[model samples]
Target chain A: MTLTPILAMRWWLPQDAALHGAALDREMYLALWIMTGLLATAHLVMLVGLCIGRREAKRSIWRLEVAPLLLLTILFGWMTIRAERLWAATRYAGADPAVMQVEVVGAQFVWYFRYPGADARFGKTKPELVQPGEGNPLGIDPGDEDGRDDRVSSELVLPIGREVDLRIRSLDVIHGFSVPEMRVKQNAIPGQVFHIHFTPVHEGRYAVLCTQVCGLGHYRMQAAVRVVSIAEFARWSER
Target chain B: MKIFSTHHRTIGIGYLLLAGTSVAIGTLLSLLMRVHRVWPDLNWPLWGVIKPEDYLAAVTMHGTLMVFFVLTTAPQSGFSNLVLPEQIGSRTMALPWLNAAGLWTTVASLLVLLSAFFVRGGGPISGWTSYPPLSALAEAGPGQATGMDLWLVSIGLFCIASTMNGANTLVTVIRCRCKGMTWGRMPLTVWAWLTAALLTVIVFSVLFAAALMLLCDWHAGTSFFVPAGGVINGVVDTQHGDGSPLLWLHLFWFFGHPEVYIAILPGMGMTSMLLANFCRRGIPAYRWMITTTLLIGLLGLSVWGHHMFVAGLNPWAGTVFQLTTIAIAIPSTAKVLNWLMTLWGSRPTYSTPMLWSLGFVSLFIAGGVTGPVLAQPALDAYLHNTFFVVAHFHLVMAMAGVFSIFAGLTYWFPLIAGRRLD
Candidate 1:
């Protein structure tokens, strides 16, 4: 990557993901604005100070106190307040009870997505039958009628404009399912399930990268996700 | 006095060399672990020659060497061991022998940890966390042999060494300042070091006790953490009925979380000082910045429950842990803003130190942003053990911390050596 001139588009990519409008986005939104103001004001001051604050034959002993204390108190003090507010919001992000639940199973080098069958309950699954067939290990049990209605997609595809409540787990090591466009990410651990919620607003495809390093072949372990309309998703998932 | 004279720089240089060498080694291990996952068949993996049992042994050893011997001992302890006294308007901290003992005890700890590699099972694979059931049972893996015992012994020794070092630092900062060096006027770096020492005094000693209990179970046929019905590799293992595996999590994280701040606070403190001095201006909100660091440390101690949210504890434990973890962000955000504020309206230098500080901010933000997601028990249930965590920790523990250490060494090199290596 070649270094661009200062006039070029700043290297920072703006926050635009769907999840960005909430929790962290609001904080970064304020942060970006404060940063811009601070930068401009500081530059103006530095240039002005160099030109005017120098000795230029003026006799004065520099007395430094109080101004710094008060200024820092306000600046950092404000930061603390903003952060505390965001910190609270980041946790208590209450979800509507009507949200749909999806189970995300993470294993060494692979991901399993299980959507409860038409009954809205997870169907029976046996770990022994899981034989990495068609690249889907931890096979969906064909013996149970619930398995027939239960949808097991090789990859994650969500309907646009619908809330998704995620239940994630790992069969072995720790892993994380991450989608940058959604600005959403979370971990998947063994013998324990973790959950988070997000609603995608746009209809498009995005890369789903594994953010945790869970042993060898970690980089090669990646998949793509597509977001489509509810009707389109129903037709695709119904198969 | 003779050793501290003209050759003073060698001590610091030697410290850097040792630290840099271990970092290089650990980095290689991490990279290789990445590679092994990416291409499991790679025959040339640096520590890849070991079998399943030995592979795990290496895992435990790798974390011990990296976090304790390399990260903890180097920048704050080793760097200050050489430079802080001189910079603080004194010859050195009081009780130089104890300081020397702390260093050697650490070296001894490293020796014991490394020796696990040559034991019967090669090394410990139970992970650096060394969770019980896996660690408590000998049949769990090959390193569970005498190797596991040595790993505990080394950590116990490290606790002693760290406690001693922390005490030395605290006493020196409080008692030995020169006439011109008042408490408020003392460098923020000194404040950070003293605070870290106080934390170690409270946290590391608890670890020392945990290590003793674990050691007793490993040898004296007693079970402090190993629970009943525990079967490793089909062998019935012996463990006391009273001790719970969760105790290790309680003991370790109590020390572990603060231990992380101990790594970061000094680096952030260095950022405050170098940026303040380099900008040719007094630090912005210097007092507030100092107080924010102390606040972060205090908040850091209370947040250990965050790591144990999934440990199947009290039903309400996750909620409490989640809240406390979120609460820590306030002080941290205050820290982030103060650093950038100090650079405002000043004659900023593009020195290597300054560059690393800039890099530090970016990495800290990157690593810290994911913290909230993990704090939620429901959220972490999915994200645990995933690549996202790799991204988070490497950003904070390895990447950001490494950048700060790099900047610190380079900035202090001139002061430590009198002749610039650059």
Candidate 2:
């Protein structure tokens, strides 16, 4: 009946660690507060109406009902526009060209992250060459010169304060690439690639979860996302 | 109880009983899921330690049963069969045999669906949405083979049953209303049933087509929903072509969004009538109530894209769906206000039916205010597929619809059984 446990543990939203997450958290809180207010007002009216009973007076339905509803509609319309602009700002706008590029591959129940290495150019991948047992999970072509320095890992490590554009795709079924702390979620579907970009503001370890139901192993389809200092990230990549 | 008999009350009671059984099983399935969620490692006598496949099977079956049998059937088919003719002053439904046929077919459909649990691979692991290549590829996983086929066939049968019943309701309302039972003169409940039946015919047909297409992809090597380059369980599927998963999303939600209204509109009508009856007066804004009901039905059809904002839909399309989805709030808000206004200043009895009606409104408001929040693509970007969505629909459609079902049963108890339920 109460959220005391949830509140005490501070488990809501899980310590946002991305630069854009604060604004998102603010937007979510604003919407929740507004919705709470609206719910309270409606319930209060219902309670009052039930208690006092109906007055048998001749009244214009327009003034008593339609006008207030119209006002509420306008308010909701404004809120929709505000939320739409926020979405366009985040999802529709292009990321900076110089933003760091990371390839995120989802297959079955595992996540694979690839860095372009010092060349800053991602190597080509072939679907037929995708043999996880052969140590080529992403099927990066061996003949591509740029692929010689490419690095692949099960963990996603990023440098703090650097905007990272994630090219997300799935080799098999559709998978959802989600990180709650970063306010990022996008479906990684086979035969297509989606680009989602964000900047991690704080250095911390967050959970990377597959939000879509890919198969039997969906529950365990998880990975770790570590945001570290630029020097630390360089050191880890070098290792 | 004769299978061929065309009695209206018998079929209605049959529908209600069927729904009751479904809700019972559906609730138990949900309880199993909740228990497993909190204590996932607790080994069971029957299933032992629950694997993810077992958990997903529960999810798929629980959703399928609740949505199809309980929510859709109980509100419109069950209650409407009992009351639509009587309220309109007709002897029985225009096509009573068709009505009985619909009920039994639904029973058979339920059996086919339940049989999936006992199949070799267990019930389908894909959620009720059944998004493919997971759903399309037989080698995708445990449930994707035979269990998935049973799911599709069951859904296909359900579509047929629903379409037949919807047509029967529409015909009875249109042709069988007794003298002077004009459209305006009909009770709000009749109007609600009428609109819901209209939606059923239009949307169920689309769903039938989708289910059949999925079945073909499963057996006939058709690729209506399967795309190329999909590897299932490490096996590459060369059978795929230009098919898209988004196409299925569009077709499914096209029926899926309005399906909620089909579940709720009758309840809205029942709530309005019950609120007025218990309050000892007609709904203050009866015309407005009808208008809002129709508006909800119309707007519900276009907002299916709201469910796909995070499913790779065009951002521009997302904007449009957002507008239409938000527009629904106006009518929905009006319906709630109409109930409150009717309750104002009228001392009403707080009996079982009235309490259920009140509960419907309370839950409706509690659940509905979150509509616009999820309607926004920006917010949904984070909240989609999260428990936020699960809670929102449970509050709005599932729980609210169940409350209305209870309200209808309690209100119509005496008329059908000739005695009040204890």
In the range B258-372, model 2's lDDT, one tens digit per residue, is 9999999999999999989998877777788889999998888888999888787667888999899999999999998788788877889989999999999999999999998
| Each candidate's clash count | 33, 6
> First chain of model 2: TM-score?
0.94
**Alpha carbon deviation, residue A183, candidate 2 (Å):** 0.3
lDDT of 2 by residue, A1-239 (tens): 89887788854667889888887888889999999999999889888877883577865778868988988988897898788888888878768988899999999899999999999999988777778898988888999999989999999999999999999988888899999889899898787788889999999999999999999889899999999999999899889
- For A1-239, candidate 1 gives per-residue lDDT tens digits of 55565558654433334543355555654555554565454445434543443222321112222344346447644754565454444334645666777788766566667888567777666544555645435556778877767776658888888888878765544555777667666656444456667787788887766665444344555776688899998988677
Q: Which residue runs does candidate 2 get wrong by more than 4 Å?
A: A1-7, B1-3
Residue pairs clashing, model 2:
A53-B344, A53-B345, A53-B346, A54-B344, A54-B345, A54-B346
Ten contiguous residues minimizing lDDT sum, candidate 1 chain B:
B229-238
Tens digits of per-residue lDDT for model 1 on B220-249?
877777654332222333344545667777
Candidate 1, position A33, lDDT: 59
Model 1 lDDT, full chain set: 0.67
Number of the predicted model whose TM-score against the real structure is largest: 2
Name the lDDT value of residue B9 in candidate 1. Answer: 38
